[model samples]
Target: MQAQTMQAQTMQHKRCMATVNKSRSMMRTYLSDEGVPLSYSRKRRIAMNLLKEYIREKYSSNEEIQEKLLETLSVYFNQVDNILQKTESPIEKTMAIELLNLIKSDSELGEIGFVDLEPQKTIKLNNRNKYYVADFLITWKPTVSVNGVERKLIVECDGHDFHEKTKEQVKKGKLRDRKLFLEGYTVFHFTGSEIYEDVSGCAIEVLEMIRSWHLSWVHG
Candidate 1:
């Protein structure tokens, strides 16, 4: 879809919009170079409110037209996630690419929703500057009703080179998991084998948990 709205906002940022379009056509998605996202609310976790707005408006009555919108978004995020792999453990690196492929390579997932996948992203403490680099940061869009929100989650991939771990490391892992939980993030841990065996199953498990949490938010 041609992101014609972006051109009117800032002339200097016009090139940012072009990245979303195909090489043949100069189209782009909602991400831009402003460096500051359009804010909405806490529940609406989407960084670019414009994208969500476009989705809602079009979904409202099926009358809005953003030609090739889905195709446009498909090309929105382009990055070399392997940049962080240099510092990651072998299993960590593997999980990173697998999860990225699981989302990007899935056409059905693309049609119903979009995801923001950032490797080595920092998650700050709820009220403190202290933060940790998450293995993978994921946020799924097109959130539906259920306490009126669809929360984000954290997936941690653990690797034991010799299938053994020190007690100290185990303690620290639990501490970090609890801290993430306290910060309102659903923390999940998968062994190298578990994720490698069937990343799709691992992903499906995560999605199911998110849905369960949404329902519990409203009913519990």
Candidate 2:
């Protein structure tokens, strides 16, 4: 009986060790990806913390549980990668990372299901070969049907130097907004200063918009 109990304990230890190794491997792979900018180390740390918290909450010392958790971690990593790859500029990238973390961490904001987040989405202009690339195109889970289509949102981070310096750029931006509106997307534009100065406030405003949409869907 003593020998049998010792063997069981040894097996459990091995399973736990395997889980730790698998988690570490996943983290390393995720961090090493080129899509993740080196400047976004804080975001990386948050991702790691979230992963660890998830594992702690959901898994035990069981090997099977660890395997399942690892699968979930893969999904999480994919989601993060998708968001990170949406922007190349430092300010935009920072804002995206901050907004993503806010959404993931906040219970109220996290409830809004995001179906797809495409960075640099290309849309052809009406009956023309010309196309415009949106900075971020987010497809939310069907809250309300807008003309039989799920509602979508566009997030544009504008830099002062490029977007505000030229009247032509401003005119083009307005045209782009009109085009997106025609395509049934609600647009939100945040300047570099606004994003850098008050990220949390910006996130709150976004949450309010989502909440309003959700409420409309539920009521209507």
Candidate 3:
């Protein structure tokens, strides 16, 4: 009877494993679809976590499974990186990389400043068919304050060809800025020329703004 019970349990486990694999395959197909309405990074992270939990449950004793999972994850990450690379201009991308590196490398500044690039913020237009994308979004938390004061910042790295090429483009940019300001985001614009000329200086300016806000929160 014990041997029969063990065999039954084994059969049930195999069935469960098959179901899990089928579910994972379906999830991968959904995530890989371009029309899934999720950012590449977000989708990649979700897929990675799903795989991680599945491996932990089913492949805890198997090194080969772990290796294969890592290989698959690497491919997903490369695809996401390629998508991001194609989305930005060379100069703007360089500036963003430099600024992020500078912010992360600073001990104190890094503690308070959290940065995300090309994060989507959906604003409903009157026509209900339009929205704006902010270049960078930063969340600043003041460490010295017990009152939990924070700031949401939008940083726009404007390219000359795209943002300021014509009067109408410039006007549209201002309108977008006003809309964001109305929505309670502190928007700062940095031209590509300024970023290229002094990337560190631009970072310093942003850091200074964060510091000022922190001090205000601390004293108030």
Runs in model 3 with CA error above 4 Å?
A: 1-87, 110-130, 143-148
Please, what is the whole-model Cα lDDT of each candidate in the order they appear?
0.54, 0.65, 0.62
Quote the lDDT for 158 in model 2. 85
Q: lDDT by residue for model 1 over 1-220, one digit each (tens)?
A: 2576666546523433342222212111111112335521221234334554654464455432243443445343223224233326655655554455455444455554446767667888887778787777777654343343546788777767723298987888788888888877878788877866765578777666644654565475
Candidate 3 residue-pair clash tally: 0
RMSD of candidate 1 to true structure, Å: 14.0
Q: Which model, 1 or 2, shows the larger TM-score?
A: 2
True lDDT of residue 124, candidate 2? 75
Q: What would the TM-score be for candidate 2 when compared with the true structure?
A: 0.62
Candidate 2 — which residues are off by over 4 angstroms? Answer: 1-75, 106-114, 143-147, 161-164
- In the range 1-220, model 2's lDDT, one tens digit per residue, is 9999999989866655555445544554455344766645565776677677757765655557666656756665666677667676655655565555555545454455444557778877776688877777766665333555466778777877545568997898898788778878889998878876775577567767776776676678
Q: For residues 105-177, what per-residue lDDT tens digits would candidate 3 score against the true structure?
A: 4557756544343433444545447777666666776555545456777777788765568899889888877
- Candidate 1, which ten residues in sequence have the lowest lDDT sum? 24-33
TM-score of each: 0.51, 0.62, 0.53
User: Total clashes, candidate 2?
Assistant: 0
